[model samples]
Target: PTMEDFLQPGNKQVAAGYVIYGSSTMLVYTTGRGVYGFTLDPSIGEFCLSHLNIVTPPDGAIYSINEGNYNHFPEGVKKYIEYCKQEDKPTKRPYSARYIGSLVSDFHRNLLKGGIFMYPPTASAPKGKLRLIYECNPIAFLAEQAGGIATDGKNRILDIQPESLHQRVPLYVGSKNMVQKLQEFL
Candidate 1:
């Protein structure tokens, strides 16, 4: 396909999935229906369905971000980080910080256990950093289908019109309520 053809928006994608290689190989995918996961069984030499109709929780007490960029982040993002560090019992204000530095791994954990993963625009790269097409879009599609949400602070990730094949965008994806709450800070 031509480069232009590859720049289509996320909605144009009929299917999206990722294979995470670790202690166990896993394949997760979606087709606007529901999210499913399969784990490769070495003995069987085949992928078997391990998770079915995956659904993300509406709220979470985990926050994932690279704190090294805290100083370079926008004031809103900084404020949000501070808010996440505060001690509040009823609402779980003091969220556990988890940053694995791998988007797919972090997102996969949150998709199942519930949490928020953030990569907002920084002072050095105000436009943000994650590739919109290959990285953000597919994950965003799965998040939405799995009863979660994905946005670049303001706009929904799936609704964004791709401007370039390598366009980068800020990402805030996770449990529905956590993501919506992050919007207030954005």
Candidate 2:
């Protein structure tokens, strides 16, 4: 039911994969660069990577989060969102919000474009929403490997240890500069 169940280091991975859920069902996976896409191929029973390393834009300007939980967020989180919102006018950056409700999807976007993805502790949930060991740690590893930064608002995610497997902690990952700014706010 959670990301921890999947993406384990020992688990088999298709290098890259994507699912399409409209009209017809399709599961596309790739073992390396040169992304490959595959349709159900009704006649066969297998997933194929037909698309190669599909070019993804590097200047990602979108963000993702559960805005409905905004009311329960800390002052630092609120301030960060406000800053993102102002990135266009006074800030002159022109960034936009794009929440997909899925950490993988959100992170995938960030992987493509150098944007920020935040899952900070809220007023109601003082700790955070994602698990430190399973979720944040692995994701942080991937993000950092892809030239991004992952932190617990103030410190690096990798620098923290999990007291429990399900332990939740604030997560702020993405562009190195953006992550650094978030730390400053914390």
Q: Which candidate is the best by TM-score?
A: 1
Q: Which residue ranges in model 1 land beyond 4 Å of their true spot?
A: none
Q: On residues 59-136, what C-alpha lDDT tens digit does candidate 2 reach at each position?
A: 456667788898887887787777777746543465678888888778766766668888988877789989876677
Candidate 1 residue pairs in backbone clash: none
Write down the lDDT that model 2 would get.
0.67
User: Residue 6 error for model 2, in Å?
Assistant: 15
Q: What's the lDDT for residue 82 in model 1?
A: 89
**Model 1 per-residue lDDT tens digits across residues 1-186:** 788899888989899999998999999999989999999999989999999999999988899999999989888888888888999999888999999999999999999999999999998888999999999999999999999999999899988999998899999999999998888987
lDDT of 1 at 13: 85
The alpha-carbon lDDT assigned to residue 43 of candidate 1 equals: 98
Query: Over all chains combined, what TM-score does candidate 1 have?
Result: 0.97
